[model samples]
Every structure is written in structure tokens, then in C-alpha cells.
Target: MISVKNISKTFKLYQSPSDRLKEIILHRSYHRVFQALNNVSFEVKQGETLGIIGENGAGKSTILKILTGILMPDRGSVNIDGKITGLLELGTGFNAEFSGLDNIFHNATYLGLSRNDIEKKLDEIIEFTELHEFINEPIKTYSSGMVMRLAFSVAIHADPNAFVVDEALSVGDAYFQQKCMQKIKAFKNNGGSIIFVSHDSNAVKILCDEAILLEGGNVVQQADPETIINTYNFLIAKRSKGEDIRYQGDDTSSGYGNYMVRIDDVSLQDENNNPSEILISGRPAKIVIRLAGEETIDDLTVGIGIRDKFGQDIYGTNSFHLKKKICIKKGQILLIEYYFKEFNVGPGKYTVSVALHTGDTHVNECFHWLDKSVAFEVVAGGDDIFIGFVRLKPDFHIKSETGNKDD
Candidate 1:
């Protein structure tokens, strides 16, 4: 378990090296103070995973460094129940000139393992990395992903009571990432505490028990993974528009945009055009998005995303993909309806996320984006028995043919 209380850190930035000398001589302040973290506090109990997410320069790295003892906070305190390890960045605590095998021994020894203990766990670590062929290769010769594999392998095998993982896990390939996630899950099941920092919302939602959002060195919100991720998205949208940043606090829906277009309302409807919180599988349904224009805009593409209860995206599409372009003038109210002839998804609770942007994606010029605007459940009444999140309407054919028997 890990506990952090009212932690704060600040850095002094100088415009030039000469300013430091001048400040010392004149006993004057010649550096600008940058608050990297301010009163940040959180806890990770045994068997729980806490995720930290924020934009760049929001003190995510600073907080991690403090938690891992790499940097000292100017105020507050941190307490760890047992040995803690961290995977902060690629090649951290590694000697570039040393071979992978040598680095394994080196890192394990640093983790408080005896030579005998290192020898016993050496093979297991190497096998987990799948780097047997390159175990003797110099660390300088390995790729970034390879270094990440070696580092993560050694860190996890150190048998730490709690581990802090930054964005280092994002370096490896998808297969290795999945392998690491499985290992993390096993560790969590064994009552290990984890503090994961990443920009991957889906991974955080799937793995974390709770999460916190940081902005400008302050903890903006702390809550369940779903709520944190929604607020994070909203924060990004607000940043893109140069708007004042504040926590929306509403988990049901968080909306943000440039104000040129506003998502006034969103609703899920059934075949009879009645609002519904429940929909039937393989039945006709529609999502109605009401938009009010604050200014004239062209090249607008409206999109919708369907996410499962776990926050995994099921489907997403935009008007650009459908070859539709919209233009709205000031005071114009538009009602966009997406009709589904067959909602062929399995029975489950899902949410509808709507966005109004330019071009094909919301990466640039996002006029409005609303997350979890509406929610509905799909029932199994109209569809055949299916076992997964989606129905493919598979067609099967059986043919009988007799072939010559082999001698």
C-alpha cells in the first residue's frame, strides 16, 4: 500500500546561467518559480489500482517521481508499507554499456535481492521478457521496445509490494502490452498496489479501480475510472478551445466545445420514435442529436460513438464517412438523426457519445463533443441467441460430398 499526503513540488527556472550567479551575489530572486505539483494527495491500497491522467506539463511525471523517491517534494509526505518499485521511463536505472543479463543482476541487486535470490529468479525474468536470444546483447544495441521489455521484466520479478508504472508500457508492441497487462492483473489479484500513469483511457478504465485527474499541478477530480476518463476528455476539448478549465463533476454527461455549435440535447429512440432507455436487439432504433448553432459554420461533420458499460468503444462513425456535409447559420437549430435498421448488438448497457467537428475526425476544429450524452440497454428479444457484444448475422452452409479414399 502507498499513501501520499498534501505533496507539493516547485522548480526554479532561470533564463540564463549567468542569472544564477547574479542572484547569489545580489541576494535577489532571478528565477521564475514553476509549481509542478500542489497539494496532490492520493492512496493506493492493497489489491487496488489507481490511475493518474493529465495533459502534458500537468505534473503527472513530477508526482510519479515523488512517489518513487526519484524526486523530493517541497512539502507533504509519502509512506509505503513495503518495498516499492517503478518503471518510470525507458532505460531508467540501466547502464547502456551493460548486457541485458548483467543489467538483470544489477537491477535485482538494487531492489534488495541477494545474489542467490537473483540467480534463482534470473531464468524466470528472462523467459518473461522473451529475450533469451538477446540476453547477452549490450543494452545499447537493443531497441526501445526491447529495453522496455527488459526493464518491465526485471521490475516485476523483483517481487515488489507495490509498483508505479508510467507511460513506459506504451513503448512495447501490442502482444507484449497484452502480456504485461495480464501480469499486472495477476499482481493485483495477489494484493499488490499499483499506481498507473498513462494517456490510454481504455486501458485505465479496464484495469484501474479508481483514478484522478490533474491540471496545472492541482488534483481536479478523483473518482471511478469511467467518470475520470469522461472528465479528462472534456478537459482536452476545453483546452483545444482555449476555454477556462474546471471540473464538470457530472458523470452522466460532460460536454465541451468552441461554442460555435452546441449539443443541446441527445436521446435514444425506438422504432416508434419514442424516447427509450431500453432497446431491443435486431430492432430498428435511432439516436437523435439536437444541435443549436451559435455562429455560421460549414464543413461540419457530426459523429457518434457507442461504448459498452466498461467504457470500451463498440462502434463509432461520423457524417464525413457517410458523405454528408452540414452547414448551419447563427440561431439555426439542427436535428441530426442516425437511424439503425438493425441494432445487432448483444444485450448490454451502452452509452452514446456525440461530437460535432470539422472534416473526418475530432482531432482538429471540434465544435462540440458530448460524452455519455445518453445511455440505453439492448435486450435479446428480437435477436437469436448470441454470446458476445455484437451479432454478425453469420450464414452457415452444409454440403455433403464424397471424396476418393486414400490408400
Candidate 2:
């Protein structure tokens, strides 16, 4: 268990040596202060995996460092009920000059493992990482991926009560990632607690039971993993739209993929093909997505998601699920319509996003088409009192009237 209360971290930025010299030389009192975290707080129950997410410089790593005692907060406290092993950064808690084998022993000891205990698990760690050939080599000579594998192997093998992980597991190849996921699942299933921090939505959806969204060093929202990821995607969408409100590094763009896909429009209507903004709960609704292909797309599949105003994904559908082929010619215009019963969804404004993905690949081939277009709301005047993204009412009745005697 972990409890963070009013945790805040502040740093001082000095312009130059002269600024510091002047402060001491002339006894000046002026100083510049930077607030990294401001009154941030959260609680993680035992055996819970809480996904910590935020934009760059949003105090995500800061919180992790504070929790692991790597960095001290300027104010507030972090109460951790058990021992913690953190893989916050690559090559952080190891001796680079030492051999991988030596560093493994060193790191294991740092994680509170006795030399004999570490020796007992040494073969398992080496086998899990598949780094036995390079185990004797200097850690500095190891590649980034190799080092990450060794580091993770040592940490998880120590069997700590709590885990603090960043994006460190993403360094290795796909095979290693799969192994790490399996290991993490096994660890959590064995009642070990984990605090996973990452920007990958899929990882959060798969591993985390709950999540917290941080914005500008503040806690903006906290909820289920699906809701947290949806809200984070919405924030990313706003940044991509070049909205007026900008967070740190919002203007920076990365060369993600060779090709990019964008959604032009999203509409919802009835069977008559007439566009209707409002829909009654528990009715059938058709969602139409219009997408434009900027380049020649081969074997393209579209994945669509519907989310509420709070950024909770109510439903997700994709063409791949239907085992359909998507061969779009160069600069082709396409319309994709998904029909489903709109049951269990509460009344709220929702946004629809469509992603152009390569067939059979889990990764989205194109830049995520998140919050591409906003749709209208569904009123909650139905008899069911369910409050969720969808409204599904299952029928339940007595099978035999004779068996059901009148009261």
C-alpha cells in the first residue's frame, strides 16, 4: 500500500554563478523557484496496479522518484507500507564499470536480497533475461536493451513487495516484452503490488486496474484504466488540434511513421440514413466514419472508439474483428459504418475516433485518430438506471407460471 499526501516538490533555478555570488556577496534575497509538483496526492491499495500517466514534465517521474526515495519532495509525505524496487531509468541504480553479473548481485543486494538468496535466483534471472552469454561482460559494454533486460531481471527476481516501473520494459524486442508482460502478470497474481508508469495506452489497459491522469504537476482525474486512457487520448487530441490551451512541449512534433491518417468526419443516425444528433437510450444507433487516405494504403483496417465527455470509452469496434479486407487505392475516400445497440450508455456528449491500422498488427499504423470528431448526446430518460458508456438491458423472467405461485 502507498499513500501520498500533499506532496510537492520545488526546485531553484539560478541564472549564473554571478546570481548566486550576488545573493551571498551582496546579501540579496531574490531567488527563482520552479514548482514541479503542487499538492499532489493519491492512494494505492495493496495488490493494486496503479497506472501513473501524464504529459512530459507533468511530475509523473517526479512522483515515482519521490516514492522510491531517490528524490526528496520539498513538502508533504509518501507513506509506503512495504519495500520497493524501482526501474525508473536505464543504467540508474547500477555500476556501469562492473560486469553484468556483478551488477546483478549489487542491484539485488540494494533491493534487500542476501547474496545467498540472489545466488539461488541467479539462474532464473539469467534464464529469464537470456543474457547468460553476456553476463560476464561489463555493463557499460551492454546495449541499452541488454542493460534494461538485466536490470529488470534483477529487480523482479528480488521479489519486493512493491514495484515502481517506468517505460523501461519497452526497450527490448517484442519477444522480451512478451516475457516481461508474463512475468509482471505472474508477479501481480502472486499478490505483489506494482505501480506502473507509462504512456502506452495498450499496456495500461492490459495491466492496470486503475489509473491517474496528471496535468502540469497536478492531479486532473483518476478512474478506471479505460477512462484514464481515453481522457489521456483526448488531451493528446486537443494538443494535436492546436487548441488555445497548451501544455508543456505541446507544440513539438515527432516523426512517428512514414504515413499519417486523419479522420474527416463522424456522424450518427438512424436506419433511415437521416443524421440525428439526439438518441434515446437502449436503441439502435449507427456510427459513420469518413476517412481520407493521403497515400496508397495496403491492407488497412479501421478501429473505431466511442467515449463520453469525461473520456470514458463506452464501446470499441474494428473492421479486423469482422475479418474484412481493407485495400484502399491511393487517395481513396471511404465511409465506415458500425451498427450496434446503444444500451447501457448514459446520457452525455461523446467523441468518436477512428484509427487506420495495418491488418493483423496490434500497433496502429497511422497516427492515432483520437477525438477526431465530436458527436451529440443520448438522453437518460429510459427506465433503466444504469450509468455507463452503453445501456444494455438483459431480459429476466420466470420460466413457469405454475411454479411461480401468486403471493
Candidate 3:
């Protein structure tokens, strides 16, 4: 078990040269401070995988550093009940001049293993890393990913009581990534607590049971994986649209309220303004949602989910923040519109459904299933010229250093 209480971190960064010299020579501080974590607190039980997610500067890495004892927190305390082994940075504990064999032993010792203890697991670590040929080479010659693989191999081979992993695991190739997942799974099954940090939503869903969302140096929401990811996606959409947003789930202790809002109709149209189920791949497509608002609907948010034929949600969007509330009088019809940048969805029979939820609480209420909404066929053109999702207009130019002979 781990308990974090009012943990905060701030760094004083010098902007001006005079300030830096004054702080060094006269012991006078003249630097602006940046706050990374502000009164952030959370707990993780034994054998539980807790995920930390947020935007680029949301203090995710700062919290991990504090937890691992790599950086001391400016305020608050982290009460860890067990020994922690962190995989924060690639080659963080490695000496570039040392051979892989020597580096592994050194790093393992730093992780609290003695020489004799690490020698027993040396063969296993080399095998796990699959670096048989390069095991004796100097770490300075190794690629970034190779160093990561070897470092990870040594860290997990010792089997600490707790593991803290950042987004560094993606450094390895797909095959080695799968191996890392298996090792983490084994660690969890053996009652080890884990704190995983990643920006990949699918990774969070696959790995964590509970998660915490942080934004602007504040703990926004902490809940189940599904709920956390839903809130995260909504935040991403809101931020992309240049809006200030805050969303919280309904208080569970207040009991059940069955105020439902369901999607009544979904239709697709092309540029010609004709009803068409089949949409072209490299064109424009529009999704229209017709909903009958039940009860007094205040600030109703609508989301359109576009999935592949196999039911994996590729991308989605919604009116996460409009600055103005979409209050629907009881029994009033509401039309919600979602326009795609371009119809870049590959040729396939895709299904479209709408979700109506409260703006404050990103909780889904009514379920609308349009099994076979539209069948779209992409008319292909250009040989491998356009790639993935939307296609952008590009300009190519050629400049001549020498003018024409006549000139």
C-alpha cells in the first residue's frame, strides 16, 4: 500500500543572467517558480494497477519522480509501504563506459541487490533482454532502445515490491513490448503494486483497474478506467476546440436518478445534400443526430462515435464545451451536428451512434444502437500518395539557383 498526501513540487527557474549570478554569488533568489503538482494526493492498494494520465505539462512525470525518490518534493510526504524499483528513464542508472554485463550488475546493485544476488540472476536478465551478442559491449555503443531493453530486463529480473513505469516502454519494438507486458502481468499477479503512466488510452484500459486524471496541476477526477478515459477524451476535445472546461461525475452516495436522454435518429449526408448510407473515403461526410430530450435537459452534450466494422472506436467527438448551455425544455426535439474534416475513413460498413449526457458529468445515460447506420465505399485514387485519416492540401516547389541562359 502507498499513501500520497498533499504532495506538491515547485522549481525555481532563473530567467535573467543577473538573477542567476546573484543566486550563486550573493545567495539571493531571483527566479520565477513553476508549480508542477499542487496539493495532489492519491492512494494505491497492494496488487492494484493505478494509472496517471494528463496533458503534456500536467505533472505526470513530476509525480513519478517524487514517488521514486529521484526528486524530493518541495511539500508533503509520500508514505510508501514497500521497496520501489522504477523504470523512469532509459539508461538512467547505466554508465556509458561500462559493458552491458557490468552495467546490469551496477544497476541491480542500485536497485538494492548485492553482488552475489545479482550474479545468480545475471543469465536470466541477459536471456530476457535477448542481447546475447551485445552483452559484453560497452553501453555507449548501444542504441537507445537497446539500452532500455537491457535496463528493463535488469530492473524486473530482481522483482521489487513495487514498480513505477513511465511512458518509456514504447522504446522497444512490438515483440519486446509484449514481453514487458507479460512481465508486468506476472508482477501484479504476485501482489506487487504498480503505478503506470502513459498517454495511450488503449494501454490504460488494458493495464489499469483504477486511474487518476490530473490537469493544470490539480487532481480533476479519479475513478474506474472506463470513466477516466471518457473524461480524458472529452477534455482533449475541449482543449482542441480552445475552450476552458471542467467535468465531474455524479455523486454516487446521493442515490439513483433515472433522468434519461436517448438518441432517436442518425443520418449521413454528402455534399449533394442527398441521403446516403455509403460515404466516399476521401471526401466530406456529416453526421446528424435527432434526439428527443426527456425531462428537463440542461447543458446536454452530444458525442458521435465512429468505429470500424470490428467495433473498435477509431475516433469520436462531441460538444464538450460550448460556453453556452444547451437547455432543452421537456419534450423538445434537439438536433446535434458533427462535421468531419474529411471523409478519410477507409472503405467499410461503419456504424454511427449518438450519446447524450450532462455537460458537467461525463456519464452516459440513454443507449442508442444503430447497428447498420451506413455502408460506405471509398473510391480509391492516387497510389499510396495519401496516408491515414484526413488528407491535407500540400504544395511542392522547385527553385533554380541559376537563371535561364537568356536572362
Candidate 4:
């Protein structure tokens, strides 16, 4: 369990690196103070999980550091009951010169483990990391991912009563990440508390019982995981309008969002799950859209369209037309995938258009619209090809002129 009351953190910023030394030597003011947090308060109870969602520079990391005592807050009080283990950074307290095995023991010791206690957990840690023979190698020689493995394994095995897990789960492969999530769930099920901080709203929803939203170094809101996540998403989208100005379109594309929601990213994948901007004719194709909204959306309609180079619309459909209602909360990334059994396209260039809107037949309800969002070439294969926009796999009957037709 953890509790913070009226906590604040401020850092003095100097104009230059040398100014810091000058100020220290002169004992005068040579810097301006920047507030990293203000009146922040939250609690994580036993057997419960608390998720923190915020943008970069929103003081999410700053508060986590304060909780772990990696940094001291300039104001307010923090009271924590039980040992706190943080997965804030991978290999954070590791010594590069030490071997993986040695670093494990060192970290375990720091986590309040005795030599005998570490020895008891040693084999399990090594086995979980799958470092194998490399466990004896110097940590400096290991890849970033390998170091992460060793660090994560040791931290999780330390068995602290409360976990301060940041976004460190982004490391390693998908399978390994899933394994770590499983362990986190298992830990919480066994009466452990977690302060889970991440930008992933869905993960927060799935793993946490409560959530907090941070913005401009302030506690914006703390409430049900879904509500907080939705508010956070809306704030993020609103923020992006001013800070994110990169082109979301190309020569054959155009895009615009209504600030209600935005398509963050899009991808084309094959049946094997390999991504590409091109598709092979008659092969399975997938369109994956990464979507986020400003607030809770209950009647969202997601649509996708395919068109030829000449702007001929080949196909288009929306969730509403199919009688499927899509509901999502803010900050939650809706990774919607549309799977097509076959491209059925002829060799040529085509563009994919996608949109998110409300009110089935109302253009005014368009929250976001993208045209030619992703352009791809459908490469024709096989000698039995015809000239058209698509392949129908036609069935035909032919009779020779000199021969009589037979029924």
C-alpha cells in the first residue's frame, strides 16, 4: 500500500551547465524553478492496482522516482506501508562490470534479500530469464534486451509487497512481454499492490482497478480506470494538435481529424503477420488501424475503403452498416484489424481510406477522415491473368466454330 498527500516536486533550472556551479559557489539565485509536480495525491491499497497515464513531461516518471526514493520531493508527504519494488528502468542499478549472476545477487540484496534468500530464488530467476550460459557473462556484454531480462526477472522474483511498474514491459519480444504481464497479474492475485504506469490505456484497464491522469505536472483526475483513460486520451489528442505537426499524408493521400479522435498509426500486414506497404494479388491482406479518442465514444463507426489509382471506389463499408457498434474510452488505442481473404486485385496501385465517425449517414459527424492513408501496389502473379481492376476467377464455356455444340 502507498499514499501520497499534497506532494509536489520542483527543480531549479539554470541557463547553462556552468551556471549551476556558479550559483553553488556564489550562493546566489542563478536559476528558475520548474514545477514537476503539484499537489499530487493517490493511493494503492493492498491487493489493488493503480495505473498512471500521462504524456511525456507530465511528471508521471517524476512521481514514480519520488515513490522509489530515487528522487526526493520538495513538498508534501508520502507514506508507504511495505517494501516497494520498482521496474522503473531496466538494468537501472546494475553494474556493467558485474556478471549477470553477480548483478542478480546485488539487485536482490538491494531488494532486502539475504545471500541465502537470493540463493533460494537464484535458479528460478535464471530459468525465467532464459539467459542460460550467458548468465555468467559480464552484463556490459549483454544486449539491451538481455539485460532487461535479467533485471526484470530479479525484480519480480524479489517478491516485494508493492510493485512500482513503469512501461518497462515494452522491452523484449511479445511472448516475453505476455509472460511478464501474466506474472504481474499473478502477483496482484496473491495480494500484491501495483502502481502501474503506462500510456497504454487498454493495458491499464485490463490490469488496474483505479487510474490517475496527469497533465502539466498536476493531478488532473483520478477515477475508474476507463474514465481516467478516456480523459487522458482526449487530452493527448488535444495536445497533439499543437505539438505534433508532422505530415499525416503523402502525394496520394490526405488526412484530418476533428480532435474527437485520431488515427495514430496504420499498417498493412500479410496473413503471416508481416507488415508491408504492398500486397500480392490474390493473397490475404490485413489493414490495422491504431485509433484514439478524446472522450468516451459509444456510437463510433469505423469504415475502410479501397480505391484504384484513378480514384475509382472498389469497396467501402462501416461498422454501422454491419450493425456492429464500436464503443471506446479515451486514451485507449483501438487496434482494429480488417482481414480480407484475398486481395483479388489486378496489378496496379491502390489506396486505402479509413474513417471514424458517428451517426451512420451523417457526414457532419465525421470525427476523423483519411483518404489514401496507405498506398500499396497489388503485384500480379501467375500466367493466367486478365486485364481488369480485379480477378473474378470466372467459369466459362467455349465451343469451336467448326464443331457442333453439345448440351
Candidate 5:
């Protein structure tokens, strides 16, 4: 098992090397302190995976380096029982001028594997990487993907009791990445402890049983993988806009529209009628919307679209699209509901947006419209499974035709 107790690290920023000498001569401070970690704490339990997620300067890499014994913390302590291996900062242990095969032995030994251990796993590592002829060439001549394959193969074959990885899977081709994920899954199933640090939220949600969110050198939230990832996205959205998105009910929703009609309330619910910002994939999606006509409504059409985090349209339909025009006078109220029996969409964060407009010609003449009025998420579940934003289940069977003479 691997554990970190209130670990923290800080660095001194100096203008130049002369500043250090001047400070020593003057017997006073000449640099500013920057805290990269602030009393952070977490642990990786045996037979489980713990995911650490954050932005570039959120101290995630610092934690990983500490776990791998590459860096020491100025404060706090780290506890470990068995050997720990890490796949971090790819291409670090490799000599640019050395051949791939030579680097394999060099790096694996650097990771604490004995010559016998290396010999036992050497063939499997080379075959898994599939570098074949290129394995004899200098690492500097290999592509970024080949380097990843080699580094990852060496790290995994070391077969430590505990492992630490920092975005190591975000390399190579899609097939190779999947292969890595499968290997990680096997490791987990075999009772090996893992500390996975990555920005790929979907992978975190799928692989990690527990997760932690970090911000500005502090522990923001730590809980189930889905909730932590959602909180991280919310924090990112706030940072991206230079403002905090106001949340009325634990959901960060924001939008704008015209001056005529107004969207009063919007929510996403399951078939049980329980409201939540999360929807299970392949389950029913029940959407409810209430609108109020603030001004006179004339020649108007209203539309609703479920979009992914990128604002790409996932599913959309409108009263106008169905030829069901909504004509209401000023001060009137409107209530609308949509039910989807099988919301077979893949896992992802989604938002429901609404728009009120007029004219059949070009969708101009806007009355009121709110983009991303209600934000929600879709999680994985159900039968045939795969990756991507959309899910289409396929059937498989073999049919046979018997001869006319026999039955």
C-alpha cells in the first residue's frame, strides 16, 4: 500500500543567480515563495485504483513524483510497504543516443528490476510493443508513439506491487491505447494497487473506483469517480470564463436569450421522476421545461437541443419541427415535457438548451432563447458496449440452411 499524509511542497522564485548570493551576503530573503501543494492528503488502497485529476499546475505531477521517490516533500510524509513502479514523464530514463533494446534493459534496471526479472519479461515486452525491426534503432530516431510503447512496455513488465502513472496512456494509436487500458484493468483485477493520474475524464470514470480533485494546491473534492470528475469540469468552466458560474441547485448552468418569452424552469429526470443532473445511459431521459411569455408571442417556434460539453448537438427537436405551433398571448404560461424511452447515448457530459424564435425561412426573429439552460451527464451501462458519443447496439448470430434431403 502507498499513502501520503499532509504532503506539501514550495519553491523559491528568484530573479537571477545573483539574488541568491546577495541574499546570503545580506543575510536576508531575496526570493518569493510559491506553494505548489497545500496540506494535501490521499491514499491508494490495495486491490483498488485511486485517480488524481487537476489542471496543469494543480500539483498532480508533484504527488506522482513524490510517490515514485524522484522528489521529496518539504513537509508531511509518505508511507510505502512494497516496491512501487511508475510510468511518468515518458522518455525520461532513455538515452537519446542508445538503441531501443539497450534502453529497455537500462530503464528496467533503473526501475529496480534484477537481471533475472528483466530476462523473464524481456520477450513479452518486445512483442507487446510490436516495434520488431525498429527495436534495434536509436530511441532518438523513433516517433513519439514508438517511444511510449517502449516505455510503457518496460514499466508494466517491471510488475511492482504498486504503480503510479501520470497521463501515460495518452500516447500512441487508438488500438495501442485500448490495449494499455485492458492491461491496466487486468492489473486491477489481479489485486495490484494503482494511482492513476490523467485528464481523460471518461477513462477515469471507467477505471477508477475512487478519485480526488485538486485545485490551486488544495484538495477540492474527493469521492466517487463521477462526482469528482463533474466537480473538476465545473471548476474548469469557471476558470475558462474568468468567472464563477452561478449554481442554483448544485448544477452549474448559464445562458442568455431574447427579451420576449422566458424559460422559467428546466430539469432532467429518470423514469422514476427523481430529478438529478446525471442520467444513466440506455435509461429513459425525462425532460421538463416551463416557459412564460413575458411579451406578446406571435409567429413563434421553440426548440430544445441536448448538446455535449463541446456544444455539439446530440439530440434536438422543436414544437415547430413537429408542426405543433405554440401561440400564446402576453402573460400566458406554457409547460412542455419530452420522454425518451431508450436514451442509448454513450457516456459523457451533456447540456439541454432551449431557444424561442419565429419565421420558417431562416430561424431568425428571436423572442427568447437560453443556451445550456440545464446541464446533465450520461454514464455508462447496458448491453452491447463501446466508446464514443453515440451508441448503436448490433446483433450477432449465425444462420444455417439445411440440405433439402435432411432435417
Candidate 6:
């Protein structure tokens, strides 16, 4: 288990080497102070994975460094119940002149393993990396993905009670990355604690029990993975405007925009044109949206997003993508309906999110954006029984041929 409390860090930026010398001799400050972290705190318990997400310069690296002992905090404290290992920046703690095989022993020793222990685990670690043929090559000759394989292999095999993973995994190929994810899941199942930092929301939703969002050296929000990811996306949309962004909605539903166009009502309709919370798979359906215009907008776009119960985005589209243009005038009410010839989604619970904005995306001019505005379930109705999230309507055929054995 790992615990952190109100930790902060600051760095002094100097203009030049002369400024540092002058400050020491004249007893005057000549550098600007940048606060990278401000009273940030969180905890990871055994068998739990906590995800840390934020934009660049949000103090993510600073906190990770402090936790791993690479940097000391200016205030607050950190406590760890057992040994912790970290996979930080790419190629960190490695010798460019050393062969990959040599670096294994080098890193294992630094992790406090005895020489005998390293020898015992060496074969297993090498096999996990799948780099048996290239293990003798110098580190400088290895690709980024190869270096990640070696580093991750060594870090996991160290057998620490907790692991701190940074974005180094992003450099690995898809196959190796999936292999690492499986190993991390196994570690979590065995009661190991983890602090996972990544910008990939899908991975966080799949692997994390909870998540935290950081902004400008502060902890903005901490909650379930779904909520945190939604909040993160909202912040990203507003980041360009340099506004003081904050979550403005509740746990069940969230929304943000300028209120030029408002979603007055949203509903799902079955083939019979009746309001419904349940829909049949492979049947006709439609989504009805009522909009009120508070200000005249020459260009407007309507978007819809469908998400599974786990908060994974299944499908999304917008009027802009469909090549449809809209214009609303003040005090005008418009009713919009999107008809589906056949809703091909699999049987599952899903939520519908709606958005009104200018252009194709909401980032430029978001008039309004609502998350989980309506919830519905799809039930199996056709003759086919399928598994997973979508129905692809597969067509299959088979033929038998007669031929000589040596044909």
C-alpha cells in the first residue's frame, strides 16, 4: 500500500549561470519560482489500481518522481508499506554502452536483489522480453520498443509489493503492450498496489478502480473511472480558451457549454413512435431532441454519442459529419429527429449523450454538451444469437471439394 499527503514541489528557474552566482554573492534572489505541485495527495491500497490523468505540465511527473524517491517534496509526506519499483521515462537508469544482457544484472542489483537471485530469475526475465536473439546488443542499438521491453521485464521481475508505471508503456508495440497489461492485471489480482498514469482513457476505465484529475498543480477531482474520464474530456475541450475549467454537473449526468443553444428534452422512440427505455436489436428506432435557441446562431451542429454501461464509447456521429447544416434564431424552438433504419447494436444497456456546437467538434464553439442524457437497453429480437457489443450481420458459406490426395 502507498499513501501520500499534501505533498508540494517548487523549482527555481534561473536566466543564466551568472544569475545564480550573483544571487549567492549579493544575497538577492535572481530566479523565478515555479510551483509544480500544490498540496497534492492520494492513496493506493492493496489490490487496487488508481489512475492519474491530466494534461501536460499538470504536475503528473513531479508527483511520480517524489513517490519513487527521484525527487524530494518541499512539504507533506509519503509512506509506503513495502518495496516499490517504477518504470518512468524511456531509457532511464540505463547504460547506453552496456549490452542488454549486462543491463539486466545491473538493474536487478539496483533493485536490491542478490547476485544469486538475479542468476535464478535471469532466464525467466529474458524469455518474458522475447528478445533472446538481441539480448547481447548494446542498449544504444535497441529501438524504443525494445528498450521498453527490457525495462518493463526487469521492473516487474523485481517482485516489489507495489509498482509505479508512467507513460513508458506507450512506446511498446501493441503485442508487448498487451502482454504487459496482462501481467499488471495479474499483479493487481495478487494484492499488489499500483499507481498508473496515462492519457488513454479506455485503458484507465478497463484497469483502474478509481481515477484522479489534476490541473495546474492541483487535484481537481477524484472519483470513479467513468466520471473522471468524462471530466477530463470536458477540460480538454475548454483548454484552448484558457478559462478556469471546473466540473459543473453531478455524478449521474454532466454538461457544459455557453448556453446559446439548450437541449430542452431528449428521448428514445421505438418503431411504433412510442417513448421507450427498451429497444429491440435489429429494429427501427429514432432519437428525438428538442432544442431552444437563446441567441441566433448562423452555423450549428448536433452530435450524438452512444456509450456502453462501462462508459466505453461505442459509436458517435454529428450533423457536421453527415453534411447537414443548421441555423437557429432567438426565441426559436426546433424539433430534430434522427431515424435509424436498423439499430444494429448488440443486446446491452447504453446511454445517449447529445451536443450542440459550431462546426464538426465541440472544442471550437460548444453551445451545449450533455452526457448520459438518456439511458436505454437493447434486447435480442432476431433469429441470431451473438456475443459482444455490436452486431456485424455476418454472412457465411461453406463448400466441399473432391480432389486427389496429392493435387
Q: Residue by residue across 175-208, what tens digits does model 1's lDDT show?
A: 9999999999999999999999999988999999
For model 6, residues 250-355, the per-residue Cα lDDT tens digits are 7678988778889998999998999999999889999999999999998999999999988888899999999998999999999888899888889999999998
Q: 1-407 in candidate 5: lDDT tens per residue?
A: 77889999998899999999999999899999989898988888888999899999899988888888888999999998687887789797899899999999999999898888898888999999999999899999998889999988898888878878788668779999998888888887888889999988777777888999989889998987766765675555445434424322234544433456777888888868799888888888888888788888776677787777654566878777788767767898887777789887788988887766665421255455455678788888766677887777676555557534332
lDDT of each: 0.89, 0.76, 0.74, 0.81, 0.79, 0.90
How many clashing residue pairs are found in candidate 4?
Answer: 3
Q: Which one is best on TM-score?
A: 6
In order of listing, the candidates' clash counts read 0, 9, 0, 3, 0, 0
Clashes of 2: 9
Instruction: State TM-scores per candidate.
Output: 0.89, 0.64, 0.66, 0.63, 0.69, 0.93
State which candidate, 2 or 6, has the greater TM-score: 6
Model 3 agreement with the true structure over 1-407: per-residue lDDT tens digits? 88899988998888876788898898777898889999999998899999999998899999988888889988898988878887887878899999999999899998889999998999899999999999999999999889989988887877688888888897888999899999999999999989999987767767887899999788999987656766676666455433323333343211111334555667888756577776766566678878776677776766666655444466666676544456777788888766665666655556664555665333443222232344444544443346554455666556566743432
Lowest summed lDDT over 10 consecutive residues: which window, candidate 6?
A: 398-407
| C-alpha lDDT (0 to 100) for residue 8 of candidate 4 | 92
Cα deviation at 399, candidate 4, in Å, is 40
TM-score of 6: 0.93
Model 1: residue 79 alpha-carbon error in angstroms: 0.6
Tell me which residue pairs clash in candidate 4.
230-330, 233-331, 234-294
How many residue pairs clash in model 3?
0
Ranking by TM-score: 6, 1, 5, 3, 2, 4
Pick the lDDT winner: 6
lDDT of 4 at 104: 91
Off by over 4 Å in 1: 16-30, 244-251, 271-275, 360-366, 381-385, 393-407
